[model samples]
Target: MAGETDPLATEQPPLSAGDLPAELPGELIAPEVAALEVPPELVAQSLGEYVRAWGARIRGGDPGVLPVILGLAIIAVLFQIVSPGNVFLSAGNLVNLFQQSAVFMVLGMAEIFVLLLGEIDLSTGYVAGLAGVIGVQLVQPVTTNFPWWVAIMAALLACAVIGAAQGTLVARLRLPSFVVTLGGNLIFNGVMLWALLFGPFSGYPTLGDQTNPHVLYQLMWGTIDPLIGWIILTALVVVVGGSFWLRDSRRRRSGLVAPPVSLTALKIVLIAVVGAAVVAICNINRAHFGTIEGVPWVILIVIGLLGLWTVLLQRTRFGRYIYAIGGNPEASRRAGINLVRVRTLAFVLCSMTAGLAGLLYVANQGGASNNFPGGQYVLYAVAAAVIGGTSLFGGRGRVLHGVLGGLVIGGINNGLYLLGLDVKVQFVVTGFVLLAAVTIDALSRRGASVGSVAHI
Candidate 1:
């Protein structure tokens, strides 16, 4: 009995980057290798070699952003052709599309925390609702009158505590994340309803009419001045583009593997072009009465958060450990990584991020009502992250993936509305799109595993 071996363990195939290695789907290998060391063959010393390397990755079944780009283009074009008056491509609609997408993007990012560690968060939707109501109630004129910033911080803090509770159950008690978070989802939803309905409030927790949190309302609806838009774009190009250039160039100079100079320049150029395009679009004056224009503040907020989280996940030691744990928990434990602390912290961050999304939802919807669709929102959050290419199995994702996926989800929704499809139809189409993405993910993994065994 003491020497008993697990039959399941013997049949476990092999460890993978985040899942069973079975030779790893090409896309999955990137995270595992990136956390350790870049493969020599994968490193390119010149522009041509870089191009070849990228091609090789695709051939190996890692399509990278290629699928996202192509799928987005197809959606846009199809919608443009089918929508009445071609309004789907109209500048006004496009800007609104971005506004519509803001919440999904943020929620997707929140899910990324535990998702990267091969965990799931079914409770994020109501968690967001609870956080939003707290922020709103804190700023109520009749009672607290807390400053907008203070209210926001309080909301995020609550999210962290919620995350801690759920994470503890999973990380310390070794409970299944799905069950823990599912329970959390129901519990938080009930708490949110209690706060909204039973709690002492002058009215429904509203960011709409409250004079105290006017700035909070403005966050989702307000636009930057046109001149400020250009200035912001310039700053973004210089700051973001410059950082990418400097980091990679420095790596190359130090004899570490990095992209070619030309490639780095290309990336900067693309950034400048895209930023300029967005600003140009936003500046196109879409108002029916008073000349309205400039980028929505939420756009910049998303970009800022993207940069922040990207740095947190890509450049920090904690980020590396998260990836390591996601890829191989036993190995991470063997390597002395504190699985409990890291896992719990990841859940905390996820909730905090989800809280921000909830706050934004308050801004967008004008209030955090008791009827908030936490269930639907959670599904979309998962749909967006997975559609954007974050593996459901984990250890292979980024904040950018969430952003990209948000756009796709946003685009599909925007297009359907333009086509005059019913809300139910929108849901159906979205489900299909999500299904397709998951199917592709599963197939890619299967293909990789078979190939791996053949080689062995």
Candidate 2:
């Protein structure tokens, strides 16, 4: 037996507790040995799981700056395509566009206040018309012959009171805004008619109306020298540059993420280019039979209002409360935000601004007639806001959005006129554009809820 030892016995080791003999077979490895090291396949599986986890995180929705920029680009392209004869691109046309959009721009800012509170003011147009008639009556010699400043103040005060009254009914009595504003609209229209029929309201002041001439008219429509345009442009650049630098410094000091230096510089450059282009365009002579140059004072007035309203909404606590109320009224109340006061103030401001726009409109037109169709213009103001990205649901919009949106609408109007299109065609086209804008807004909101990049 010793001389004939088995070959298998010679290769096998002595079995120990918890150990397997080598002759047991390759497939008979102990479970403990198998568990000591992971297989390459297992490692590959774990890596796949990790990748999927990270992918999910990356797909989450995040607010970004791309949407706003893309919107502006698409607008520019559409206008270019629709009116390719350089008429839309001409310097004179651009200046005219700004002038034409001034009223809507002001109205848009007015709407912002109500929009922030998730409310609407259907009476704005009629209110403006009534205020204009009152303003003209006050300035008329047959009336009290009040100073222009006094008349303006009276008109603004009247509008504010009406607005406050409406707000009280809505906020205190819990009345529906649609019904309240609709009633107010009718009342204001009656007041306008009364003022025109009974009050001593003269037409707008003409160049040679009075012995001293109409200084106010001159101020509104007069042209500035080219030198003045350049000076104003330079001042604007300095102020805007200083503001950006200060903002960046504060952000850095607070350990907040500031925009990249390149991005900041790009913004400044873009602003400067736009300002320069505007100045150059306005400096051109557009007068065919007479001398007309530079921008209208109404243009400055509109821009000033825009800046003021933007600051109010973005920088003030009141503005914050308004937005809060719109977003979540109950939550805002729990946080001690006064819904009544803020809502009232917003309505008052909106009405006063509407008055301002109305005055500007009459001044630009040089007269106001009963057939001015204030109601139609009011609808246009609302449409402009919606088209410019102001959410109907509220708590989201910008003053600049209104300006750009107004310009887009004004451009369409001007372009259609230049192309010799009928007024009916213009109206139809505008209606379609408004519809498209609203559809896009709805789709964007839906996309945002679903974690899609198409939200814009």
Q: For each candidate, C-alpha RMSD in Å?
A: 6.8, 20.0
User: How does model 2 score by TM-score?
Assistant: 0.79
Tens-digit per-residue lDDT, 1-456, candidate 1: 998753212222344457544464565465433322343233766778777766655555566567777889999899999999988878899999999999899999999999989999999999999998988888877678899899999999999999999999999999999999999999999998877863465337677565667888988998999999999889889998889888987887888778778888888899999999999999998999989899999999999999999999989888888888898888777566778889999999999989999998998987778778899989989988888888888777888888888899999989988877888988998899899888877776676556545444
lDDT of 2: 0.69
How many residue pairs of model 1 clash at the backbone?
Answer: 2
Candidate 1, which segments miss by more than 4 Å at Cα? Answer: 1-42, 198-203, 208-211
Best by TM-score: 1
Tens digit of per-residue lDDT, candidate 2, span 1-456: 566642211232334545434465443254322322222222222435433333332233211222334555655566656775856777767777777777777777777778767899888888888777766666665546777778778989999999999989888888988789889888988888777775433433322354112433443465677888789778878887778878866876897656555455666888799878877888788877777787667666776788788888877787777778888876666566667778888889989988987777666665566765678777777777777777677776777766766766776777777667887987898788778777766665565456432221
